[model samples]
Target chain A: MIGRLNHVAIAVPDLEAACAQYAGPLGAKVGAPQDLPEHGVTVVFIELPNTKIELLYPLGDASPIASFLEKSPAGGMHHICYEVPDILKARDQLISDGARVLGDGSAKIGAHGNPVLFLHPKDFQGCLIELEQV
Target chain B: MIGRLNHVAIAVPDLEAACAQYAGPLGAKVGAPQDLPEHGVTVVFIELPNTKIELLYPLGDASPIASFLEKSPAGGMHHICYEVPDILKARDQLISDGARVLGDGSAKIGAHGNPVLFLHPKDFQGCLIELEQV
Candidate 1:
């Protein structure tokens, strides 16, 4: 079951520049960046109490975010992270209900060092979804 | 200066069905609904700490969310809400930097009975942005 919005992930061409944009003009504090090698993304977060803004850039080949940027043609919102109590169950149910899994159901450390998985964009009407276990 | 994300709005055609899907399977509480006529939307909110999920349905034909539903042809993530300490100043700076405002920068009571304004999608590369002052 989806609990709440954990984060809103944005695809950015430049993480440092985007972080500066948020931190300087928007006055949002950028958290330390982390690289999720499995997903081939370098993610930086703007911390909020419940939800966060994750600025993502491609780290290597076969990264989903890179394809999203190419198709989107403009850097913008990519996905919504939904917090779930049981990550495996949520992933299974979502897949059974015709949701596509971008990654195999595997827990990997994400921006906040939390276990996370991504859902394919084809599942929820072209919106990529991330399932995070907290 | 910014506060926490108040709501992450999504454009949906069926409010009742969406509410049912969320409340039934998601094990989440749906708050009381409110219609902001000025923005031409009947918004329902899912409460969360520092963040919320707003299910938006058009109240009339003039709503920007309506056109987005048409162009997109698929329901997906619509916008990201950034809680600002001063909405007025945020609007000013964003506009100066080539951000097109969908509204004339007026404060209308949104789903949570708080002042809210929408930023044009053109400014954020086809991603609609909402600014709420809490």
Candidate 2:
């Protein structure tokens, strides 16, 4: 069901600071910050050889990342995404197998302009799993 | 400096239950549990097409996962591992760039029999980062 590891998402209190850290010390090629209104966060992609690292910051008061930051304060990993060949098939299989898909159990367009679904952290042993159609 | 995303580590409360969930519902190829006394955790790797998912549980009272579980209780994503071509080079570069390398600033043999070093979460936006020499 899960394909390649798409990208790992990290919630940051300040996107620019995170970008500087990666760009300077980590020496990564960091992309321009993109505001994902639909996802309620601004994101920057740090290009890596095998995969990308996504840095996320809250965009709105209702943003889930906002709440995550409220609890963590120092920022933390938000989720890890895995690519899937088919989102609908994966979603159905996960649901039928008793895993709870988040947000009305439907696929939504993600940052990559691909269909994505989030699995509940509880069902996946406290890790928010995001499956993105590639 | 990072070669590939080796694996995403999740700290689980119950190793066996987590394994069952992945093997049964997720239909993943779960590997046998291995105990690392040095790291103080028992881990099982779930192989995916593109990468692997590591499930970790406390091995002893002083295990770091035990402390993480005490705070989270429900288990959660613990760290993300990236493969580096040379562990020593990566360590020196990260330290020179002001990132705090965890432990005594030395690489230890990890589960895959590879040298590994951990970075402090505070320096990397609260996400514990691991670099394994591959």
Candidate 3:
């Protein structure tokens, strides 16, 4: 079951501009950009009172967000993550409930270094959902 | 300044199915649908530990989410709402910082009955941002 709302990821074409917008006008505490080559994206975290917001930019040619950015040139909401206690159990339960898991149907190390799994958007009200074991 | 993330709004074509998906497979507490004729949408609130998720469906002929639903028939993230101590102050600061405020640049009563203003997606990393006085 989903616990806390971990973070909402927004894929932006200009990472710096997005970071500046949140930090400047929005007056939110934003973390420095960190490039995750494995994830093929660079991420900046915006900390709110209750949850965080992630700003993502394509890092390499094989970046997972490249296509998303292409489809939405101005960038857009990518996914929303929820914290789960046991990702494996959650995955199995979701599978039994007829929800499709993305990738190889296994949890992988997410940008936050937590074990995370992505559910198919078709199964999640057209919103990409990421489940992270916290 | 933005404080808490009040909620994330997702426009769905099938409100009941979306609510069932969150309550059943996702295992989140979903509230009963409430039709806001003024807002031109019916909303179901999903309560999470940190924040809420609003599932929206077009309620009338002039529904604001009708076009969004047409584009994303399966539903999608519509906007993210952040709590602001003073909506007017936030709006002025955002405008001074070169951000475009949606509507007539004035706060209106939002679905939750709080003063709210929407920011242009072009100015906010392609994400529609709602600022609510809370």
lDDT of 3 by residue, B35-60 (tens): 89877999999999989999989998
Which pairs, if any, clash in model 1?
none
Q: Is the docking of candidate 1 incorrect, acceptable, medium or high quality?
A: acceptable
Best candidate according to TM-score: 3
Which one is best on DockQ? 3
lDDT scores for all predictions?
0.75, 0.90, 0.92
Model 2 chain B: weakest 10-residue lDDT segment is: B20-29
The residue-by-residue lDDT of candidate 1 on A22-75, one tens digit each, is 777567879888888877898888877556888888888888778878877567
Off by more than 4 A, model 1: A93-100, A120-126, B93-100, B121-126
DockQ ranking, best first: 3, 2, 1
Candidate 2 similarity to native, TM-score: 0.95
TM-score of 1: 0.85
Better model by lDDT: candidate 2 vs candidate 3: 3
Return the lDDT, model 3, position A53: 98
CA lDDT, candidate 1, residue A95: 64
> What C-alpha lDDT, on a 0 to 100 scale, does residue A119 get in candidate 1?
76
DockQ of 1: 0.47
Consecutive 10-residue window with the lowest summed lDDT within model 1 chain B: B120-129
TM-score of chain B for predicted candidate 3: 0.96
Please, what are the lDDT tens digits per residue for candidate 2 over residues A1-134? 57678899999998889998888877678999899898899999988777888999999768999999999988998998988888899889888888899989889999989999999999888889999999
Q: In angstroms, give how far residue B14 of model 3 lies from its true place.
A: 0.7
So what's the TM-score on candidate 3? 0.98
